[model samples]
Target: MIEADRISKTYARGVYALRDLSLRIDKGDFVFLTGPSGAGKSTLLRLLLRRDVPSEGQLIVGGRNLAELTPRQVQAYRRSLGFVFQDFKLLQNKTVLQNVALVPRVLGMPPSQQQRRTFQVLKWVGLQHRMSAYPLELSGGEQQRVAIARAIVNDPVIILADEPTGNLDPDLSLEIMNLFREINARGTTVVVATHDRELIRRVGRRSVTLNHGQIAELA
Candidate 1:
């Protein structure tokens, strides 16, 4: 579960990315964060991931106050959640399997377990056949699928995807959305930040809309 209480993020030049934003996402819920560019969608996600600290207010994720965590604890906290980005962010030099295996490898998971989980998740995303391919060798949709596989390989408590389907075709976008739905059904909390209104409407999940750095609607 995640809670943000009157959180605000201000950058150096007197610019505010979020203004007194308050929201709560319960465990096992799927939510869409829809807003135009500069509306604080990515800022909120970054705050949740502890990639950046809020300039004001509090953020609690999985019962731990983000503001109070030590640097070491922040690293551990990140491992408990998965992040997927608009750009796939796959390593161009690493093979699909290796890229997906990076997290567990970094966490000191045993080689056998890493191999097993990586392969299993690749299959889940229907990319098992392309495991040995590099990022540039695959299509855009394939690359995103690999990203999804990498995100879920560790079975994190929550998944935060920022414009996950931003680069794919409409059909592929729907495919990715359905994949997120499936992941949500399996009990992982999922929050996606996107401006794709058509996709959001098609999915029909609870949506929160932001305008001018503040939540304007929740439906």
Candidate 2:
């Protein structure tokens, strides 16, 4: 679960990115954060990822308060989370298999286990057949699937996606959203920040719409 307790993020010169916002997302929930650019969507996501701490209040994920974690605790906490981006950040030089296997390898999973896990997730995302392909060699949609595979390689408890369909066409965006829905069905919490209203309506998940750094609407 994610709980933002009246959190506020103040940027340079006291600009408020998030202003005393509070929210709760339960486990296994799939929620969309939609708003205009700079509506504090990304800022809230950054705080949830612990990339940036709130200027005031707290963020708690799975009962852990982000503000009080030790550095090592922070790293461990992050391990339980997955993040996807608007841009597929796969290493250009790496094969699809290598890219998906990265996190397991980094954690010193034995090479054999890493290969198994990588193959498993790649199959999960329907990219098992593209294992030998490089990022540039794949289509845009395929690259995004590879990115999704990489993100879920750890079997994270929560999946946080930032504009995941921003670069895809309408059809491809729906395909990606379907994949997310499947992931959510398996019980991982999913939070997506996107600007596509049509996509949001199609997904028809509960939504939180922000305006000027506050919760302006909920649907």
Candidate 3:
């Protein structure tokens, strides 16, 4: 479970990114976080990722308070969560298999298991055939699939995606959304921060809308 209780983030000059906002996302939930530019969607996501702490109040995930976690705990916490970004942050020099396999290798999994798990996720994302190809050689949609495979390679309990489909065409965007649905169906909590209202409408899932650093609507 993820919970935010009266959290606020303030920048210099009294600028507020979030203001005493509170929310809870239960495990296995698929939620859409929607708002306009400068509406604090990214700020909330960053706080959930523990990249930034709130100026006031507590953010809790999986029964632990984020603000109180030690550095080692923070690292461990991050490893258990998946994050996908608008720009596919791929290592240009790495091949698809190598990129996805990097996580298990870093976690010290046996090399054979690393290869097996990497191959599993790549095939899950329908990228097994492109495993030997570099990021530069793939199309935008294929690159995004590679990124998704990388994110889920570790089998995280939660997935956080920020504007994941922003760069894709309508058809490709729909495909990616369906892929996320499949991931969510497998029981990973999914939080998607996006500006795509049509996607939200089609999914018909619960949505939280923020404005001027506060939640304006949630349904």
Candidate with top lDDT is: 1
lDDT of 1 by residue, 1-219 (tens): 899999999998979999999999999999999999999999999999898988999999988999999999999999989989989999999999999999999999999999999999999999999999999999988999999999999999999999999999899999999999999999999999999999999999999999878999999
> Between the candidate structures 2 and 3, which one is better when assessed by lDDT?
2
List the candidate 2 regions with Cα displacement exceeding 4 Å. none
Model 2 steric clash pairs: none
The residue-by-residue lDDT of candidate 2 on 35-111, one tens digit each, is 99999999999998899899999899999899989999989988999899999898999999999898999988999
Candidate 1 lDDT at 188 equals 98
Please estimate how well model 2 matches the true structure, expressed as its whole-model Cα lDDT: 0.93
lDDT of 3 by residue, 1-219 (tens): 999999999999999999999999999999999999899999999998999999999999999999999999999999999888889899999999998998899999999999999999999999999999999999999999998998899999999999999899878988888888899999999999998989888878889999988999998
| TM-score, per-candidate, Cα-based | 0.99, 0.98, 0.98
Q: Count the clashes in each prediction.
A: 0, 0, 0
Roughly what TM-score does model 2 have, to 2 decimal places?
0.98
The C-alpha RMSD of each candidate to the native structure, in angstroms, is 0.7, 0.7, 0.8
